[model samples]
Target: VDTFFGDTISMVVIMTCCVVGIIVNVFILVIGYLDWATRKKLPNCYMIVSCLSSSRLLLQGTVLYSTLCQGTHHWNVLRVQSALLVLSSTACLWFAACLSAFYCVKIATFTQRHFLLMKLRISGMVPYLLLGSMLVSLISSVPFIWTDFSVHLCNSTRSSVKNTTGDSTVGNISYFKVFILYLTWMTIPLLFFTASSTLLIASLWRHTKQMRRNMTGFKDLSTQVHSNAIKTLISFLVLYFCSFVAEILLGIPSCLAKSRWKHSICSFIVAVCPSIHSILLIFFNVRLKQTFKGILLSMRGRILSPFVLSFVLIIN
Candidate 1:
């Protein structure tokens, strides 16, 4: 009964997260598209963010499908699922890292010639970088097509005639392959994200300190901009760390501990990260925030206007 109840709760949470993630990512894509349409050109940051949101949408969809179709033994299904998982996860992380790098390059002020060159070239480089990331994601996912994940199954009954040595060898090889794949797919992107975020934070911190030293009690526009940027980055860092830790935990076999509930809980947390972070992004971005606010106000007025008119009529 306890296990059943826990599983029920886990299912509810996971489904809710998956639904929310899909909705938020879709909204992000729509907003990005609308902005691009209006401006006649998409900025590098917006482009990267749209790609990230799209990848996250696919990732959440994959998670939802996997959860719903658990325990299926079809090779083709498993292969497709594994491939999609790798592709989406890699793309999501890579795009997020690219977004971080874009932010750092655009917002950070440096006197170095190389820094100036990077700032000047970043827009031109964005499309190529995105292409490279997609290629890398595809390459990383290709291995899943040929790899046999059956060795990881906890319940495999072997007859006495079965070749134990061969089985052990295959299992060892599979484990090694998965380890390398995880390292390549997860660790590298994480390092890139960390490095970019650190650089941005350091740059912001230095600028904030310099501003404090130069200015008095008066808060200037530059200081305000710096403060807002720092706050946004800090918020992103917090959410990124939470999502990263959750994903790492989900990937680690020992963390699951043979408990479906534990796995479901981790998956739920992972699914929530993308949606929550996207919402945070919308809130932090000035144009998106204002647009969202306007929509809400319009909606409220529409809903209340009828009631207000009816009340006025009654008074008359």
Candidate 2:
């Protein structure tokens, strides 16, 4: 009874995070679409944001579905769901790395000939990079069709099977393969993300120092931009690191995998990363921030108008 209650509470928390993430991501997509419809052109950065949000949306939905269907005996259902989850999660990281690379090329004060040349071509390369990310994610997820998550589930639920050496050996080998594949895909984007983000942050810090030397005010526009960008990059770095840790925890074959509550906690960590990061993106983006504020004011006005009218009628 106690275990069931704990599992229920964990599921609630996971569901809440997933649902909130889905809503935020949907808002980002809608805003991106509306902006494109009005301006007839979406910038490369905006395009990347939209793609990231889309992947997060898919990932959150898959997580919700996986949580809901955790008890079903259908291995095929679990197989496809796991594949979709991995594909979306991989795409999320790749898109994030692309976004980081884009910001680095666009904003960082790099003067090398190669850096300048890459900057000139980066806009043209965005579509190709995005396409490559999708292809990679798809390729990484396809191997899941042959993998059986049910085997792990069964082992976790049964104690007698746990003592079998042959089964443990087979399970270890299978888990190692999955871990290797997941780590391979994860590491590719992580490398790009780390390099680009570090470069951007370093460049911005130098620029900020130069601005200070010029007797610029703390509130100077350039200084503010640099500061905000640094903050965003740092926050993203932390979230990415957390996501990496969570993925490692999930991928590793260990006793933690057998614990229902521990698994749920890891899932929550994974789910919260994209959601919180999306909110950060919205706050850091001027256009999105303005639009979001306008939305809130409009909502507040609507909610209060009826009360104001009722008070006016009473006075009359």
For candidate 2, the per-residue lDDT at 272 reads 91
Q: What is the lDDT of candidate 2?
A: 0.81
Point out where model 2 deviates above 4 Å. Answer: 155-175, 254-256, 301-316
Q: Write the per-residue lDDT of candidate 1 for residues 227-270, one digit (tens) a residue.
A: 66667666766776777777666655432245565577678877
Put down candidate 2 lDDT per residue, 1-316, tens digits, no spaces. Answer: 9988988988888899999999989999999999899999989989999999999999999988888877654556656886897899899889989999998999898899999999999999999999999999999888776674534554544532232323221212254577589889988898999999999988988887877788744567866776777778889999989987886777655343566656777889988998999988888888887777666555546757776555434423
What's the TM-score of every candidate structure? Answer: 0.84, 0.88
Clashes by residue pair, model 2: none
Please give the range of 10 consecutive residues that has the lowest summed lDDT in model 2: 164-173
19, model 2: CA deviation in Å? 0.7
What overall lDDT goes with each candidate model?
0.75, 0.81
Total clashes in model 1, counting residue pairs 3 or more apart in sequence or in different chains: 0
Listed per model in order, the count of residue pairs whose N, CA or C atoms clash below 3 Å is 0, 0
Worst 10 residues of 1 by lDDT: 156-165
